[model samples]
Target: MESKLSRNEAISQLVLASSSPRRKELVASLDLSLPVYILSTDTDESIEAHWSPEQVVEQLSLRKANAALDLLQQKQAVETSLIIGADTIVVLDGDVLGKPVDDDEAKAMLRRLQGRAHEVYTGIACVLSSSGEAQLAHRMTKVKMKPLSEEQIARYVATGEPRDKAGSYGIQGLGSTLVDEIEGCYFNVVGLPLSLLSDMLATYDIAVF
Candidate 1:
């Protein structure tokens, strides 16, 4: 069989401008042989607290991509590199919930989500350093959480699994038990939307099987 990457010229590196392990795993699933570079940009995500969820994520993703592109340009190692930046946020009743600051905060977030449907928005941006072109896309998934008792929330919070995740839950981890149903891309809830990402990458001559 011919290689999926055969149509594209080889990339010097695939730079991921986020510190998310879930994003890394999703990208690795593409099975590309290029080196993976994890570059976390210190972009401030403090928005006006009034932007829509989709707008918030897309803006953050773009900022991250631009920051990484600037860094690559400064280093002058600007060979053919594709930088992928992503941002995920949980929206409940028009409020954006990011990672929790404490166990109490996590528990509170989970309690609010219990028996409620929320939206998970993930923004993806790909920048081609050689061409200075970037593409940004956002995916939103409606996720319903199963009703959880106080004991259940306490037990789950004690596991310390929700502290580092948006909406105080990790859909791919132990938090999966709290999910009742999902109405869109499961990978988007996890952090990245693989199908949409594949389509986006294809525009840059990168194919994903």
Candidate 2:
């Protein structure tokens, strides 16, 4: 049996269009032999009010991937690399809970999420730097938060882990204590769904072997 398989020869590298440390770490876990580059971009993330969670994440992810592709083109360094972009969001009671601006907002978001189940959506986009070929997909996970008290929420908020996280928590960090149960890809809640991402990469002749 073969322990390794050949990949697309034309594809020379993998470019991640995000600065999130968690995402970077997840990509590193794949351990692909190709060189991986971090080409973060400041793409506009705004969306229409009526867009559903799926639409919101998918569009934002593709937007970032395209922005990175443009940057590579301008530098004339787009030598058959693959650009990977992703976006994750938390939805509760039909409302999107983005990153909190302050501790008060974080506590408020957590308060609403306590003792309830919410959905997490993670969208992934892959663009071939050479031919401009693009692929997009998303994964949804159901997360149930344990019932939390005001003091517990306050204590967690003081830890400062929820500051930049959606739904005021990071399931992969200290926030794990707050979750009662989860259904679907665990990586989806972390930020980038590994299974979904691997599948998309396979379409571009990239495999995890």
Candidate 3:
């Protein structure tokens, strides 16, 4: 069998502008065998309260990608690297939910989401350092959570799985049991939308098997 890396030209040397282990794992699962260089961008994600969730994610992703590009330039590495940056946010009833600040915050988020459908929006940005061209896109997934009793929320919070994740939950981890259904790309909820990322990469002559 051919090596997975040999099957695609577009993703052979992709850089991931994130430190998210979940995003890394999701990209690796594509079997592309590409080297992922993690360069966390120091971009402020605070958006105007009036901005929609989709817009917030998109802007953040672009900011991250640009920051990574600047870092690459400072390193004076070869200018052919393709950098990918992504951001995800959870939205409930027009409110943007980010990582929980504390255990109590996580519990509150879970309580608000209990037995309700919320939207998960993931924004992706791809930049070609040499050409200075970039592509941006957003993917939204609707997820329904099963009703959780007070005890359930407290128990889950104790596990500490929801502290570092948006909306205080991680669908790919212990939080999976809380999700009743998903209406779109499962990977999007996990962190990055591989299908959409692949599509965007393809535009730059990158391919994934």
Candidate 4:
């Protein structure tokens, strides 16, 4: 009985390795007994041109999780940590769209995305600090956008929401107006897939229920 209690205490904390408000909110919604700690990492996000979209997000998520683990180890605060890292990307016509650097770029990405169906791929990685074991997974959602005129795209860009979002739109915010339909996990497009995360957490003895 004491051993079981000790194991529970060992995984009493969840470290989220991301700066995304959407991800933070999603994880918090789980209401797990384990306290959540946000740890954002600025790891390298560049990917090879030939890598598949799945590979891109998975590798990036792992990198972010590992980076966060390194930070916690340096601070000597990782003894009871289970770190999660996630990366999302927008793929249209075999091309990957990342966060735009400027309004013009955002506009261009939206332009191509308008009146089309694109796939949103989000990868999640969980690293157990005590065991140094990492698990990775990804979710894909097909999103169809409403046809928008140049004026509409310009107006959306003016709001400054797309500048920091991949594919130049956020489905959970004002950008929802631009989407006509989605065929997979909605939370995946929001930057984190809760259902998938919950399952991964279970593997580490972290239960939401």
Task: Estimate, for each residue in 1-209, the C-alpha lDDT of model 3 and write its tens digit.
Answer: 23434333343477889989998887787766557678887788789878888788988998899899999899997737788899999999999999999999999999999999999999998877775577789999999999999999999999999988999999998999999999999999999998898887666656586
> Per-residue CA lDDT of candidate 4, range 1-209, in tens?
12334444467688999999999999999998978999989899989989999999999999999999999999997457888999999999999999999999999999999999999999999887876677889999999999999999999999999988999999999999999999999999999999999887776677789
lDDT of 2 by residue, 3-104 (tens): 113335478899999989999999999998788999989999888999999999999999999999999999999478889999999999899888899999
lDDT-wise, the better of 1 and 4 is 4
Best by TM-score: 4
The list of candidate 4 runs beyond 4 A from truth reads 1-9
RMSD to truth, every model: 4.0, 3.8, 4.8, 3.2
Q: Model 1 — TM-score against the truth?
A: 0.91
Local distance difference test, candidate 2? 0.90
> What shift in Å separates residue 121 of candidate 4 from its native position after superposition?
0.3
Higher-scoring candidate on lDDT, 1 or 2: 2
TM per candidate comes to: 0.91, 0.94, 0.91, 0.94
Q: Local error of candidate 1 at 191, Å?
A: 0.1
As a TM-score, model 4 comes out at 0.94
For candidate 4, the C-alpha RMSD (Å) to the true structure equals 3.2
Worst 10 residues of 2 by lDDT: 1-10
Every candidate's lDDT: 0.88, 0.90, 0.86, 0.90
